[model samples]
Target: MDKYTGKRLDGRYEIHELIGSGGMALVYRAYDEIDDRTVAIKILKDEFLGNEEFIRRFKNESKAIAVLSHPNIVKVYDVSFGDRIQYIVEEYIDGITLKEYLDQQKEVKWKEAIHFTIQILRALQHAHEKGIVHRDIKPQNIMLLQDGTIKVTDFGIARFSRSETRTMTDKAIGSVHYIAPEQARGDLTDEKADIYSVGVMLYEMITGQLPFEADSAVSVAIMQLQADPKPPKEINPNIPDGLEEITLKAMQKNPVQRYQSAAEMLRDIEEFRRNPSIRFQYKYFIDEKPTKYIDAINTVKGTEQPVYNDNYEYEEEPVRNPKKKKKSTASLVITGIAAAFLIVAVGFGLAALLHSCSSGPQDVPLPNFVGHNYDDVKNNPAYKNFKFITETKNDSSQKAGTILGQNPKAGTVVKSNSDVTLTINAGGKMVTIPDLTNKTQDEAVSNLQQLNLTYDVLPVEDANVTKGYVQNTDPPAGTQVAEGSKVSVYVSTGSGGEKVAVPAIIDETLDAAKKDIAAAGLTVGKITTKDDTGKPKDTVIETTPLPGVQVAKGSSVSIVVSSGNKSEKSIDIFVHLPKNVTHDINLKAYLGNELQTEKTVNPSYNDVCQLTFTGTSGKKQLTIQLDGNKYQVYTLDFDAGTFKQDESYPYTENSSASESVSGPITPAD
Candidate 1:
């Protein structure tokens, strides 16, 4: 039996059984006797009671969860740090860990992953706002209920930002597989580290594998430091590009580059949910002149350096022929007079040109062309003198070829024949839908995405096509459809047979029950047995989702069987006479102090005796007397049907035999 089972603590909580165990504590399913409610009590291990580090971690978990009250976070109800033992009472969660759930699923669908991740982010967002950083955020610490609710647990290494002192040791904590790069390096950690861990978990959820893995923890940690994982899309092509970008952004090696907070990441997830095909254009700046090392060089003296004259000009001056002679002053005067006459004539010609420019065409006010048809505007007599420059763009909100925007105001004045730039809405592009019949879900999604189209999967029961394969698409294949439109892909759900009623197997034998269940298209699941006097042993007492209830084909039916009544029990006892006894002696026996039988035994003939006893449902006391002296006292627990000798006299001088002999002792019988 466990040490804590059936034990009561502080006269209020009664521990039932050990539910889980960890390195520092043992969790028990305990009932609060005072409040009449069940809770999980995490008791510090006896071996670690004196170890300060273990004690601190145990207390840290209690403190961390005590402050958090989110729907997705586990709740702590009470804490006790006694002299002999310490424990924390928390809400009992009846579910498996997320890690186990993921293992069973192998690969989670992107939509399901997003659902779980959104809940987790909401929890983290609350925690981050409260200044708590859950240093460990792996799937193992997440609990998944049957209804798909998530509960984040195990805050053993959590830290509070408001606290001045470090609650955890300097050594690297948390699982190395999902720890952030800074955490692996034992660097200062903040909320962003938790985001990194969440990103790793999301990657694993969608890709069915961890971002980094190796034979040893050290190798994995090293990979966390230096290696860049392949994007989730490469592993699972069905993952949306926007989701992949969000995941990778959160997993950035530099904390400064990752999502600044969980709320930011949640916003991106919301955007992805609203428009699955939406892609975020994220950009990061890279320093072109990154620091580098250079070779050492010898020093130069000031005189060794090249010098240039400040007054020197590098341009060459036009040179004159040395043989040429200068002209006379009178000839120079005549040339100057002709130059003056040419200047006067050029001034009069420039005045005539200015007078002609002043008589140009008049300006006109440009009309609004944003919503007007391009053809109408081009043929309008009022705008015949103006030029129109059109650019086309795909805008789903507006009609095809409609002018969306214009550069200048409608009332702005411009010269005739001036350019008027306009942006036209070209609407959605049309593309021929490829044949998607019999294609795998991933392959179909990839093909649709390549054509700038989105898809919705509708799973149908198909007896011919395989599961996860496309049976056919809506609008059929080879049909022309607008780009960015949603296509319905009919996915096969395998051959799900007709639903059948569950047959009643109560009071039937195990083999018979199994046959009946199989005949009803169901299999046995989690058979359990209990003591029941109403039914024979190995007979089915009851079943889960009771008989006659309709269930899908191949569903499992759990059953409980009878292990017989608890009252029917019997035991045999054997005894030997003492060697010192020389004469014939009378032996008497009593059960529960009531006379049973009396007999005489001769030592020379036989020295051993055998007896049988049967009873109802409680412990029975057996007493034997030899020659009127008490020989042995035994206890027989009729409930379990086991016997043990309490004490033996071994033939003493005192004798007190009082019962009448029922028969003469036969030879050793």
Candidate 2:
């Protein structure tokens, strides 16, 4: 098992098992205690923690997805880019990757392929419109749910089209077999490149083979740049003509000939879906030879018919009689002379009209531009006579790119061609700060960047918080701040107290782990038992504050030992008591019918009491009594280490019966 398999991160994501691994990250199936849901966490591999390039790529994926919210795209809930570890928490997908499915079945039906392609295209359309390009669009990055839904994921190599222009590497950035010709040539790529990759995937699905194959990736890249893929029909004759046309059009070697945008491609797919037999018959003349015109007698017209020239424009044949042609030419010259004189007269009239208005430039009232898109207003033909002098300011209250203020106020008469200054809102919008506690400096900064916010990191000595991780943020999390706001992030140095690394106790016997903890100058806190079929009884399977985490010496370390697949597991629950009771009360806690804890407590002395509950790893009912009157009913989650006060009853001093109540009870201290 991996070291993180049974560990918890940030005290919220409980890593259960390693589900998948990629080139630079490992994916784990974890349970989110705070959200009470299962999530998939992708952690950057330990080897690349110090590699800046890999870290950038890892951060890029989260940044790319943070701005995109589509049904066919994976959702990112959290991210942590600590110095030692980096991870992204995303929605758990209970499905297989498209690559895995393709491996199981070499080829998919054409209709099924189209269905999948449509979803992928929809996802790309959303990303493209947001100025994002998923350079890597291959089967490996596509997830297929059991219900036939397609999810596009893995944006590690994605690029923002508006801000970024060139590729980071000299070689191709994506899979060689699926990348566009321009990508293989190391040319600047855009949304069209993603369309090409989608086309390649469609080809593989329909033909059950790659378009180009060679001994090495470099050779395959060459093929992508120069080779023409065999038509899908040749490999699979059942492919619809229109579908084939769409695929080939998308796979065109030149970007100009390919689908301009994902939306444009979707329209073609929609047309085909409406009518399967429809044929676009799109023609390309780039590779064809010049057309040859053969001489033939014109049956309808005794004179030779007009012939097409190299430019595809029509030209009349030369006349055979010179005298007749000369007469015609002279007539044409006379008409040309008359036309030239008419043009000169018209030009003089226009010049006179312009001279009349030359005294003063044409003037028009300046129209209101505030609350309108600056680009729309600037590009409007009505405003063409005026030159716009644009300035931008960060105003989170207004929509980005919208005109916030205009000089030469609306209704003011401004001369034509006059420079009008317009102030546009540059800040995107306001965003609520997400919980940044326990996140590392890099992770917090990345999150701030995603929201268009800036940050300053402050390293403070804190013993309660992990070293190198965020202890808190200025204004705290959940505060709604405008975009571009500077937030100060406080990071823990773990130096306020003498710190010791939590000794590795996973897989060790409970007695052995206890001895290790004692040797490390830490006392054993609580030992919880979980039913793990993979481990032997009494073997430690997990630990609190995880191994290698630095904590103050003498601090209590908790361990979770395996019960060896027992029918039931042991759990600990904390029962709250009223601390201001004037007299002693009999406090009894019952887990179902079994009495777990029975004690006489003076509420003024003890504010809380601990109770042990035995049950399987699921919700269990707990009944607590105050002086024989049912005080509260609680539901406990053993696996998540959480509980909810389902029902509460008010207990008055010397009251004979329990009074019904609402909400949770607070321990009066």
Candidate 3:
């Protein structure tokens, strides 16, 4: 057994076992006694205790996740930094690593890959907006839940945008296969590096292989810097062209050519999802300068060829004709006399034209009219030269008659009396609200966004409508309202059952508490009695799931009643046997200091067995031993109705009978 296993830290977290180990830290599944929940504690390794760099990275992970709060990102709960021991407590995710899942599945569909990529990008977008760059992103660092949820984890090497300092070992510290070109080259990196990593993961998912792989890490790093990956469609013929383009663009060698941000990449993916056949106008190789076309129809062997240039003007080269006769002396004198007469006539025309232009209206710069009343500006004597074109819009946020916008904009030089259009606010505009009944949350949100309105989602219990679908909208739908008004969307929690908050029933009589529970739409469950010195017999104590916790209507609410005398309570627990138990195995259940039940069960008959225990009324320790190895534990509040099982270790078929299991474990109701 590890040293930290079975130990309590700060008298609060009871560490069960080491779940994972990284280069600088070890993760343990621990129970938070104070919060009454399980959390994963990441403690710095003893070997790196003296290393300041590892310590810094460990602390940085906490700081990075502290500011980030997203559904697709792992959440941090608490941090403890002591001289000898430093650890961060985070949300315990009951899932397997993405790397493990991929290894097991071998091949993933392109659509499924896209679904995963979209979630990862959403998480990165949230982090990037907060100025945090997740420098290390890979399948190994991602957690995959059974419900197809993705959680990005492991920010030990993340960088903040505020800091530009580089560490000593910065080159390819993240996996070389997924690092961006700039990252592989040890160049300064930002959120784009994370995007590049995501692209690599997506490529791997669709192709079932890495884009660039070599015998050594150094060779792979070189490929990341200088090599171009084959298009995903080439490897997987089923991949869509739009998705392949999006992947390659995100994995571009040059940061400028890559998707600038996660949100930008998400938009492209969303478009692809909407229309699979749609192709984006993303040309990878295009001339920066305009192409020049050669002039045709101008080919002379001896003389310079007359040609049309870029400006589209025709120029003719001079050709000498020595053999031609020259009778120009007499003709030149006549031409000069005619030219002088033409110049005199043109001079008179120019003088007349100049005299006409000097009398026209002069040009003046337009003035700004925004934030001012249109009626005042139009009637002012100083603004009498220009013509006012009025356009009104309903804007409840702006004052009535105030100019909301202008056409010519402030400084455009226009002739006097030119038309200037001014848009004025007419107090408020009325828009007919669209019916959002029975629509999904996303559909309703999209409709509201298109109407230039905002919305708030409120989940309510509706027995008729399906969960996550809209039940109704505030202001009821189809009512005329302002364009920018906020609509309240009441979404259905579920059908046939509605959620209700558990009422506080402590200190009430058992009979009265049962009435309250029934009034709250909850059913009274198994009643257990506890020995109490202060409270009267049959007095109400506490209930399961505590107070204020939201539970479904008609759900069981177990009650613990107080008894003045010492009373014995019995509990029935279901035990699931491990798959490795091929032969007959010994299973024992304990209550407090004594063993309650011992049974020999064969695996072929039933994998699960029911264990019954009887103990004196009070809080007692409950342990399950399989083949003489402690496999599970629970705190039996003989007083609190049914037994409360501690989820410190969940059971799985692949788990060894001697070892506690992790990952997905569906509990019995």
Whole-model Cα lDDT of every candidate shown, in order: 0.75, 0.76, 0.75
Q: Pick the candidate with the highest TM-score.
A: 1
Q: Which parts of model 2 are misplaced by more than 4 Å?
A: 288-669
Any runs in candidate 1 off by more than 4 Å, and if so which?
A: 165-170, 285-669
Q: Per-residue alpha-carbon lDDT of model 2 for 1-669, expressed as tens digits?
A: 236767899999999756566878988889999999999999997757765557778998999999999999999999898888999999888666788767655347777789999999999999998999998899989988755789999998887899875553233577778888777655578999999999999999988999999876766766776678999999987677788899999999889999999999899999877555456888864766332211210112244333211111112222232442222346877989887997688655754564454557777898998899876675454676777888878776776678998999999998887888999887665689989998888888899999888776655666688888998887789997667767767778665456676786777899999999998888999988876435799987767765655567899988888888746555555556775576777776777666677678776777767676666577777888887667878776664434555776776564342234221234455
592: Cα error in model 2, Å: 78
Report the poorest 10 consecutive residues by lDDT, candidate 3: 307-316
Candidates 1 and 2 compared by TM-score, better number: 1
Cα lDDT tens digits, model 1, 1-669, are 346768999999998766666777878889998888999999997756765556777887888888899999989988999878999999888666788767655346787899999999999999888888998899989987755789999998777866733322223678888888877655567899999999999999989999999876666766787778998989986676788899999998889989999999999999777555456767765555432211011113334332211111111222323674554567877879876897688655654564464547678888888887665566454576676888877778776657888878788998876888988775677788899899999999999999888777666666679988899887789887666666778787665565455675766899999999997778889998786234678988667755654467888889888887675666676666887677778777888667687778867677778777888677888888777667878777676455656777767543432344332222222
lDDT by residue (tens digit), candidate 3, 1-669: 346778899999999756666777889889999999999999997756765556778898999999999999999999988999999999998766778767755357677799899999999999999999998899999987755789999998887876645431222457778888776645567899999999999999999999999876666766776677988878987676678889899998888999999999999999777555445758776446443211122223346443211111111222323574543566888978987997688655754564464548889999999999776676454677787888878878886678999989999999886889999886687777789988999999999998877676666556678888898887887887666667877777664354676676777898889899998899998899878434798887656755545577788888888877755666666666666557776666766557677777766679877676676566777877665556677766555323545643533333254334222122346
Question: In lDDT terms, how accurate is model 1?
Answer: 0.75
Q: Residue pairs in steric clash, candidate 2?
A: none
- lDDT for residue 235 in candidate 1, whole number 0-100: 94
TM-score, candidate 1, is 0.45
Q: If ranked by TM-score, best first, what sequence of candidates would result?
A: 1, 2, 3
TM-score of each: 0.45, 0.44, 0.43
